[model samples]
Target: MRTTLYGQFVAGTKTDEVKQIVDKFKQYNVKVILDYSMESDISTSITASNNVHKSSFNTELDESNTFKIYHPDERIFNTNMFNYIKNSNTSRELCGQSSFIAMKITALVRPLVLQKLNQFLESRITDHNLFDTIDSLLTTKNDFTHSLTPNELGEISNLLLRINRIIQTVKKNEGRIFIDAEQSYFQTAINKIVIHLQRLYNRNNLLVYNTYQCYKK
Candidate 1:
């Protein structure tokens, strides 16, 4: 019960057969963090795309007929398929199974949306990069607004929905969601959207969590 670990000790670390562990921790009045160790479950990929892997990936896949040999980008979502994750995580969370979701804004929002928002943030009051540059981006469906190819556009759209769904889940269950940060080259871009989401969703409290990687110059 009285543990000692600096790093965030994930929930599953205690072990699935945790009746004794739970009882011991309860005696000590210890708090617990929800961390599902289903590393294989969420937005991850199965490596070794050989016949075995290919056959395995196809197992239980709904689109059996549509399945074909495709590149990784085509097969998987730019940041883990949203529909698959929504269904998977939703079920996992409901089972009192997984908690403490560590996700990325990049996984959900299109890079170009961040790019446009970052660009506007840098413009001076008179820098004349019309507000639409960023404003429309927020209002419009980011999935269809980018200059990427048709297939790329669809992939990007999946990410937007994935983000929306993730937030909806966090909001529904009052769960904590952490949005991890990246390099300085991306802070502004990440910040712009994160703040927007914060203001939109985090009015009462810090709903959209943003990580600041402080190792940069």
Candidate 2:
């Protein structure tokens, strides 16, 4: 399976191997879209919470518990962003112009954070139109931190800075970025953030593209 499924899909784990594969693709006039695959979804945390509740009667912290939660700190997320940017720069170096970078907001910011933001927006914005809600989110003067608590405001700010760093790398490399979409529950927040990036960086040229699932309503 590793030689077939993983080998057919993944480029390589090492820089030299990946460069060789990327160059081979370039020989066929194909551009690379490098994606950082490490991510944690909100549903994982929810399931862990359920398991923890189920084990509440134990009254002791079980070191052998298999269901660990995913609450990554800002430092861990920043490290991930740094590695992502480094890999993206390497891809640009190997593939040159027209190469693309694919990134997920959930990878940069905590999925739970996105879930909270989505819940807040859904509660505040009553409109059924998705675009309308996004526009409302973008136009807000408070930078979408109006009703958020201090810690949440800090998280949002850090999340924006991380995204900006990624986009800035794409702009510097003269490459484009594809903001990968998430599940329906997280899509609204992702859309709002990506549109904000488009407004900022895509004024002169199309550099940021937001991906949407066609099968989704």
Residues 1-217 of candidate 2: C-alpha lDDT, one tens digit per residue = 6657897778888879888888898789877788877677887656644543333332221133421222335555777788879877987887778768888887776677688788766675655454453345444536456555444455666677778888899889898889898888888778778887888899999999999988956
**Top TM-score prediction, candidate number:** 2
**C-alpha lDDT of all candidate models, in order:** 0.46, 0.72
Model 2: lowest-lDDT 10 consecutive positions = 60-69
- TM-scores of the candidates are 0.50, 0.77
Clashing pairs in 1: none
- lDDT over C-alpha atoms for residue 211 of model 2: 92
Question: Residue 76 error for model 2, in Å?
Answer: 1.4
